[model samples]
Target: MSRQTNKLTATAVKSAKPTDKPVKMADGGGLYLEVRASGGKYWRMKYRFAGKEKLLAIGTYPEISLADARKAREKAKERLSEGVDPSMAKQLERKLGQQVAANTFQLVAQEWLERVHQHDVVPDHYQRNRRRLERDAFPVLGKRPLSEISAAELLACLRRIEDRGHVETAHRVKALCGQVFRYGISTGRAERDPTPDLRGALRPHRSQHFAALTEPSAVAELLRAIDGYGGQPVTIAALQIAPMVFTRPGELRQARWSDIDLDNALWSFTASKTDQPLLVPLPSQAVAILRDLYGLTGRSEYVFPGARSHKRPMSNVAIKAALDRMGFKGQMTAHGFRAMARTILAERLGYPPEYIEQQLAHAVRDSNGRAYNRTQFLEQRREMLQRWADYLDELRQAHPSSSQSSAQ
Candidate 1:
């Protein structure tokens, strides 16, 4: 039973002041008033449970008064009588309170993003996931608790995005939502992943290949249009190199000078999609472009730094906007350069499929079942890339404005 004697008074608690050392006064039962040298007051209870001593924090004084502390002591005594350790009970309460606060879908999803980033997942993947959450998931389910969210509600949120003609985005959102739910479950904020129930619920997503102009005449016209682009010299250089190399726009924009070896005439970096190191054999034309850009942006890290600041790479919108200016708005994507090069190099240039695939960094396997390593066909790739650049020059020369390429 809790000791009924009371030794602390409201007036004494008000008069307590900081000292050189902490002072703790007993109030009876196991409750006491602790005064710190920093002038902080805390209420605590000490008790024995199952042959072990434990401490339970009642609260701060003034917030929890002399009378309330006794009531709390009595409550703890009752718990101890029922074979429950007061300290363990208090810890459980705290954990439950934290779980309650973090139960919301938004909170759980943010936590999931932090874990993804901690494991070195790509920043673009995180940003895209965040965007989908804000657009489709957050408005409807952000504030709702993960345990309380039904599969139907999540499906509705995804269906809304699908209804707007973004089936792929909708499916991606569902997968991410599942990831967040699983994260929450591991953290004790959710019960089960609701995404399993959503299989076949969303409309089937058909992947669309990037529209590209593969014909020699079309590529020539596109080259002429890019050459006449009224933009910064940096953008013109990026546009010129886009067709000359089989690299994704993201890789090109984020290109670092440290990753380029002008002496070796090679650009090497780890590709984000495959998480594999790739060596891009720089052709003479590409090397010339980089050398000229060196004079302008050599000090900066990014080859195509943004116009306003050199700290960041140029925005993907810059490329899209330039393509729009060239009147190939929807007809070409920044990724279309890959398809264009693939088709032309294979069909027109008469390069071997293996050589082209290796240069493109596709996940092709060799006869020995080993994955194509970065330097698998280095010398052959070096020859093929230079040939590809020369072929592009040949195609450009067929245009009426070809002489301007020589003059410029």
Candidate 2:
């Protein structure tokens, strides 16, 4: 628009009428009220950048009044003087506004949960982290802006978890918070990961070893008790095979029909902790227990299908509940079976440590940093496991109250 063209007024902008072609009501200085052919009114600014003409939207009319449009136009002129494109400036401003809108700790944390936590970790690990965040972190810092969350505030949040004697959980949650904040920084939502500032702030967590029976006599008692356990057949079968295979309770409970090769007397599964394939050389006693169970659950996907839902595996809680009923709550956990087998395999059976580790399916890596093969000690493990089962039978027979029940 030239100086000679009359400036548009608020009344002219309000009553602007549409026509077959769009009309521009000049407000001078390259600003105009655009009346489109479809009866839409817009505020458009015409400018030149890098020798090309461009249109920038200041805002729609009625929301951006005449005074506001003039101010916006003045701001655009200043940017032009600075050799910056006004249109590019508007786009950047919108992007920054969106960044500001989504920089809240809760939103960023939720994003981290989906993109990093759940994607990288196992499902059970993700669930535990999710629950901790909901119960501990979300209540304190969820809605706050990531920029405003200080180290002190987060330490206070973690200290609350420690006060409740959840020392390890507190440490874990702190590590998770660090992961979330670092993700926010990487994604341009936060400035810093405040967790590093909290170094040595939380108390160290002491790990308690799982209580297990390493003594031959104690093992005899546990085996005898399993024989007399008045529980479901599935439960009884699981108890019977535990001493022979000594698999992690979760892995044993989640065993599937396809994972078992009864003809070859081998039970295969992927280890949950290390995410590696495992092959447990089933002894004759263990194979007998599984063969008996096949008559009950061979049609289902899970060898030990849930009582309530055959589609799913048996509940870990139910297995633990059975342990509680057998007077082994704190004295012995289901995981204790692994420790018992690990000790006796090395101490009594005199198996090589490498062979024992292989049978335990530990995450042992070779010199090339490749994981040891799943069947590395297959033959040795097959021999060792059978001897362990026979030794357990001998211990049961040596006991004072040996019922001499069949391996059926």
Candidate 3:
């Protein structure tokens, strides 16, 4: 027996009045429009699977036009002909869609950042990494499934960043993507990291070390210039203290009042890079500068609070700008103080490298190759810093021409 199909036209379906009960208008091949008494029109299909009749709801009228409804009906029939149940197939497609949506690259990267990355780095580092991903990677590959992103596609994203002449940033973005991909693999959201396949794809970029003055004469001149700077009072104080401590600029700016004990001349805080507790034995010179600056910023949390707000730390570039003002822009940098101290301490003052490195909070390994503990050379480092401060005092007080020969 052959059942008639296409018995309803578009006009007939639209003009068909709803009765007191629901009515079905057949279009063709198990497709029909259900006109409910409540004025709702919906498209449905009636089909047989394993000898049992079932229904599939396509969509509503107008939203699902007649041509679109016919196409959907044909696709559903194709699934049925392939020995698959169309209703179950539709449900499976929907579930897969939901799964893909849940496993998007952006979502996985965010989970990685919050659960693992944030806790591993300082807040500013975490924030900068997040911003890098947002600006560079997220807009392109964010919505795609992490496991499905090919190596070439990811490289294309990096290439766009490279094309902008930000070769270093492009490399950094690539590394960040690699981290997210590795995280995805560990969390079962991705099958593998594609970044390994991208080796040698990026343009070669020469690494540039931070500008530093290792010469004792230049360091002496730099110290003299820092003392004479006429900036904000807090900035002047920071400049005075910078060479004495020579901790990373971020660490110095973020120094808290509670971390210092003027009586003992020690500052103790966790190192941002190594995440280890560091003990800085402040010289009498550094302690004096702190004591004088305390009256102005003693109540604030940060030793070097921001200019506009006491709640936040000072701008990271404050010292760099001060150096530029002092005519030492290319000659020396704020970080140059570390190289200056390390060089003179070992080459001039004849201090052991171990003591100077330990004072610098660097990871100096023992004979067995294990990292030495924080307190390993405490007493020697204390003496070394005091002497280092005295040496700086000598340099600052020396006549300009005599500064070069004043080193011990």
Q: Which candidate number would show the highest lDDT if scored against the true structure?
A: 3
Model 2: per-residue Cα lDDT at residue 344: 81
Using lDDT as the measure, name the better of candidate 2 and candidate 3.
3
**Which whole-number lDDT from 0 to 100 does residue 226 have in model 3?**
80
Q: Flag the better candidate by lDDT, 1 or 2.
A: 1
Query: lDDT per model, in order?
Result: 0.86, 0.84, 0.88
Query: Where does candidate 2 have its weakest 10-residue lDDT segment?
Result: 399-408
Model 1: per-residue Cα lDDT over 136-195, one tens digit each? 898999988889999999998998899998889998889889889998888888889989
Q: TM-score for model 1?
A: 0.73
Candidate 2, residues 20-52, lDDT tens digits: the string is: 999989898889998899988888888888899
lDDT of 3 by residue, 64-99 (tens): 877888888889889888999888998999999998
Considering summed lDDT, which 10 consecutive residues are worst modelled in model 1? Answer: 399-408
**Stretches of candidate 3 exceeding 4 Å from the true structure:** 16-19
lDDT of 3: 0.88
**Stretches of candidate 2 above 4 Å error?**
1-29, 35-40, 50-53, 62-68, 92-126, 129-165, 174-199, 365-371, 400-408
Candidate 2 lDDT (Cα, 0 to 1): 0.84
- Quote the positional error of residue 153 for candidate 3 in Å: 1.0
